[model samples]
Target: MQKKAGPFFYVFLALFVFFVMFPFLWVLLSSIKPLGELFGDKAFDWFTSHPTLKSYVSVFVNYPFLRYLWNSTVVATVTTVYTVFVAAFAAYAIARLEFKGKTVILGLVLAVSMFPQIATISPIYMFVKKFGLTNSYLGLIIPYTTFALPLSIWLLVTFFRKIPFDLEEAAKMDGATPMQTYFKIIFPLAVPGVFTTSILVFIAAWNEFLFALTINTAEKYKTVPVGIAMFQGQYTIPWGEISAATVIVTIPLVIMVLLFQRRIVSGLTSGSVKE
Candidate 1:
């Protein structure tokens, strides 16, 4: 006979799922509510009110929402692309190449990942200013890649280590150069890792608030997180508009996660599997 899940197991699972999803559901529901009805007195009034797209329209019309979205998309996409290429090569070297102090190098990479982004913000700002990169795509892109590289390299290394060296040897025997072998053989096999790293780097760059706020002073150059944060003032918070912006910024990420869910699962599982 098939075993049934224990009572407490089901209870805990339900609670966990609810805890994870409640905020997203609340935001989605709130996004569609009318401005006045959003914080109405009735407990479930927000749910019962007629929905409107005014807030969304106002966001696009009143602010440079499209500009911010475009900036974020460009930054995130470029960062993801650059990071994958650099990290994949670094990971391949660390995993497959015979090098001295590999353990020390890996440990240093981990240490860099552990360093909080805030701790280096001042230095990063100074560097950006020195290069006249502030408010430019390069400004955000450089920092995003720096912060993202460590984790991306580490994860790719883990995945690359699982791939057999015999594949590389076989490719070399067929007169394939190292670059050709990596491009033709290893890269195709490392799709799961590439997808995982790209998604993470994109999300990090997309949702980054602190650096974007500090570096990109122009409203047109600001990312979604910074744009969302500036959606209200002290005296009157436009909850409707804020909710609408939240929904707008959230949809792309949600779609990306859904589309690459299988690759994400495979990447996570790859880390656990040995050869």
Candidate 2:
């Protein structure tokens, strides 16, 4: 049996958690503080004497924040769903099937994933504009899916390889067709990987700022990231409102993680066996 954690472990753990959570804690504290207290002499204080939900109210009351939220949700969800659907099949093939130049293909996928978004943005923007797809959800969705796929494919490839081929052989012996085996046996067992992939892809797409700002020009098409940027006044930034919006947008992610924490942990930690 492993020994229990020592005092040093608890001290390090507390420090790690504090540093990791400090930014979010600050944002949370700032969101509830009254503007006068937040910007006034008491700004340095940690606790707020006058805590209120006014900034959160301003988030919805003063702006079309919900529409921006819907835009982000639609784009992120579409990108995640499409990327996972395509990546699952692709990864399965790479992991299980015999094929030529498989190494080269995987290398190319990794190369594509490594290419900076800045390098591709110009071409992508021009192509979208040429096709009159600018300032639309589709424009963002397509690019986001493209960028997310390479990593998703790589992740699923590792996961698919971890699954025992004996399972596949058993399914085949049971008169299960190849497609049925894949759909029924492999996919279900790959749930941990899929759940993990969806979370990463959704978070990437949801929090992406440069692409959202570059591809979507219309105010109505703007996502939460870009919409939050609009909180800047001509000369002054609305810190409280920005903090509130940050909190609002973060709730969904927090909820998703809470809901799928088990799968995420399993996905990251699985695959210890050897043939």
The lDDT per prediction is 0.84, 0.86
Question: Model 2, 84-131: lDDT tens per residue?
Answer: 899988889899888998888888888898888998899889988998
**True lDDT of residue 257, candidate 2:** 81
Question: Can you give the lDDT of residue 162 in candidate 1?
Answer: 70
Clashing pairs counted in every model: 0, 0
Tens digits of per-residue lDDT, candidate 1, 196-221, equal 87777677778888899999988878
Task: Please list the Cα RMSD from the true structure of every candidate, rounded to 1 decimal place.
Answer: 2.7, 2.5
Q: For residue 231, what is the lDDT in candidate 2?
A: 84
On lDDT, the candidate that comes out on top is 2
Superposed Cα RMSD, model 2:
2.5
